[model samples]
Target chain A: MISKEEAAQEAGWIERCQRGEQEAFAPLVERYRSAVFRVVYRVVRRRDEVEDIVQEVFIKAFTAIRSYNFQSSFQTWLSRIALNHCYDYLRRVRASHVTYFWQMSEEGQRNLEATAESREPGGLNAEQRAAVRELASQVLEAAPPADRVLLALKEIEGHSVEEIGEILDLKPSTVKVRLHRARKRLLKEVSSRARVRPGEPAGAPRP
Target chain B: MRCDHVLEILAEGDPRAREIKEHLAQCPACAARARAWRLAQAGFRELASEPVPEASVGFTPRLMRRLAESSRPAPAEQSFFEKVGRRFVYSTLMLALLALLALAVPRSGPLRSPNSAELMLMQPSVATLQDESVLNVDGLGSHWPHNSTVTAPAAGGQR
Candidate 1:
């Protein structure tokens, strides 16, 4: 829960920044930089792009400081800017390369399918987990910006529906519905595209 | 095959991945569901780590430089009010200078010299005076019988 004192302090800083005190805004940036950076990196897995994206997010927030509404926490406002930048970057990449969400080489697809159909019937080990992460990096970017962002925030960032609604300007019910749809798309697409293994029962779970 | 249940499991991310796997073993539809969710969760976990990075020593300085730069306006850019004020000052000075030169410059033209000897020539001529009198040339009241064409009003007055 946000306290009244913290809110007042943030308001004071905002007022000062709006009044042209550049240094007064530093504390605010220092306070939220890590949180903002994390959100950017969660969606943008490229190490090279992540830092630039994070910098861009902060710069945008800085430029638009006067328009920030005090009703929402400063963090949420900053997050909206960060996620939008990530979407723009994702869109630009998609437009330039015509990358699809499920594009993978035959060997890559086989490895993903093999990982999904591991014979252990046990928990995913470290290597399997790493492979899954690698596959996610590709698929998440290839997926629709809205879907990947929703999934990243819900599953990866662990934001509640209410928080996401405020961040994305969506209703709570809408957030829930969109979140489900995004997960459904990822799960369904991955399952349908994964190749069947040799000598595996057609209807079985690759056991 | 309850898609709702599978969706809930994926969203919830609980009951231990192993327990979910055990349940998936008997349920074919859910097995596939679990497979997808398991892959998704692995990625989620991998990506979620270190949500924020530690700020580098140079980071805040770079940010300060940016903030400082942002507060400073571009060399070529100016506000609307500034442009209007500059233009207003320039226009006002130009008009004032024109008025001052108008007063300081000598009025030596023939029209400006009202007391000059050429003022007599500037007066109306006898012909113009006769034109003003239709039936009286120089007030003699001579209505000539041969001048029938001068019955209408003078067209020269219209010019």
Candidate 2:
């Protein structure tokens, strides 16, 4: 949440931008660059492409700055543009069959299974957390682009359904349905891809 | 409850959360589904804990440069419809000018073919005037013969 003063300042910058002042846009970009980068990185999981996508998102926002009517926060508006750019990037990546650096190795797979099956009580250790991150990355790669983005937003980024709906221009109920389906699909992928010991099935319930 | 329904309830966090606990105890399949959901949730929690990447140094400068470049307009490349519309306007203007010329030409000068009577009246000679006594010259009496084609008529009197 932002204070009213900050919002007014941002509105001033946006108003200047709408009047064709390019310099006013710099402050807005500097303010939201990190947040947009984090979201793009979480969704795309591609460190190399995140910067480029973030730049495109800002340029798009500035280009369409006139359409903004202060209906939503500037961050939410920027987030919508970022997610749309990520979707396009994911589609292009899918079409080009590009390989990602986060593809889980054999050791990563083993660590992932061990971490999931571990019966430890409290917070996960660093190694277990790394394993889980690896598994999340793998799941993101295997899932379709839409599901990948939704899962990243809801699960990894910890955004609420209402926030996600605002970002994606979806109803809260629709966001709920989509989030449920994405989780189920990703779980199915993990079950099929992650291996189990001999005479035991994958994704077996905890004893 | 069916395993799928149980999973849906679990995923959605339905208010009837107690029902799922009972169903999990009764059905092994549902129990497995519930366990998988827990593991997945755990994985998500861990993933969420992972550090978020920050913008690198000079990111703003680089982005501003890119924005400056994007702000620069490209050389104008007209679309097919625009080209057609331009041509249409030019053609309409030309047609209007042609129509105006057509309307002004006959009013400015006598460009139409003259009839024989008008031709004879235009180039009258003294001999033709004498030969045709009934021919009126310079608006004189109809039956009188004029001596010369270029003769001047007395003011307010017959030539």
Candidate 3:
């Protein structure tokens, strides 16, 4: 983890870069690349596009580094840059008629579809597995956009609440509440589809 | 405590542990609920644990190159204005320090003049009377015509 003081010191390199001291920026890049890559990978998901997005994130960060006030850690600031790029890419993808599933290699697409199909909870028998897989795909297709994003970040990417908050610009408490609600909604959908009786809801209403 | 409340705490952990311990001391029903919630949470945790894919091998170098390219200096040389700006900042800072020192030090003192006679005359109680005849000898003395005795005002009088 980069400390506030360390980030501040690195900011001096940005000032140098602004003055045309290009070499000063190498260490800054080395320190923050992994943090930035993790954010981009979480959103974009595709291996090929991850590099392009990561590159774009650094370019954006370099162009805007002067405006950074050092209020947050450089890692947090870099994460925001990567996240914004990922969201922009997602939005662009959504606006176009292109389907991400279609863009993937056949094997990749098959694996992803397989995962989606078998997402149902509880151990299932052979017949039940097939039925549950079919139903899981339908439920996922029906899930809200925000819920899907939350699930991808929390469950698929395995991000901690604090990390998600930094990436999403949400408070930790808010992230927890949203994640808890997202899981409950997914659970409710699965339970409803299974026609299985729920013992009780997972958690109480958040104050 | 309500089962709902106990379940919420159990979902989060230690907070629910303490709550359950206290509730169990009195209410067996809520305590039982806590135990069930804990078991469920543990099971969910196990199911949720999946290995994330490793970051691609070339990611670091590719990122570094991108960052390097973005931070690269312009092909054109530094303009005269930029050079002047840097010098201006340094000069301004140095000048400010000098200005501060000038303001802090006492300006009036014996080091400023070779003659000590004026300093001796400025003593609080000393009254030096210069004869007008000495001024007449030193110069044509056209201003001493009225022979008025000019004396320093007494202490505390406005000059």
Compare the candidates by lDDT and give the number of the best one.
2
Off by over 4 Å in 3: A2-9, A18-22, A97-149, A152-163, A188-207, B1-159
Candidate 3 chain B: minimum summed lDDT over ten consecutive residues — where? B150-159
lDDT of 2 at B73: 59
**Candidate 2 local lDDT, A47-76, one digit each (tens):** 777777888889899899998888988898
Model 1 C-alpha RMSD to native: 16.4
Residue pairs with clashing backbones, model 2: none
Writing each residue's lDDT as its tens digit, candidate 3 over B1-159 gives 664455445545554566566665565445334433332332233323423244466765676566665555644455566788889999999999999877644233344332222443464353333544433432434576544543331221211
lDDT of each: 0.69, 0.72, 0.55
DockQ of 3: 0.03
Angstrom error of the Cα, residue A73, model 2: value is 0.8
iRMS of candidate 1, one decimal? 4.1
Ranking by TM-score: 2, 1, 3
Tell me the tens digit of each residue's lDDT in model 1 across A1-207: 458997788789888987767788788887788888788877776666776777778778878888887778788899999999998888888778855455666665666677777644246666556556666666576578889888888888899999999998789999988888888778765565554223332235422
Q: Chain A TM-score per model, please list them.
A: 0.81, 0.87, 0.60
lDDT of 1 by residue, B14-123 (tens): 56556555555556666666666666666667777634555567876787787676667744455666788899999999999999878754343244333321323453
Q: Find the candidate with the highest DockQ and give its number.
A: 1
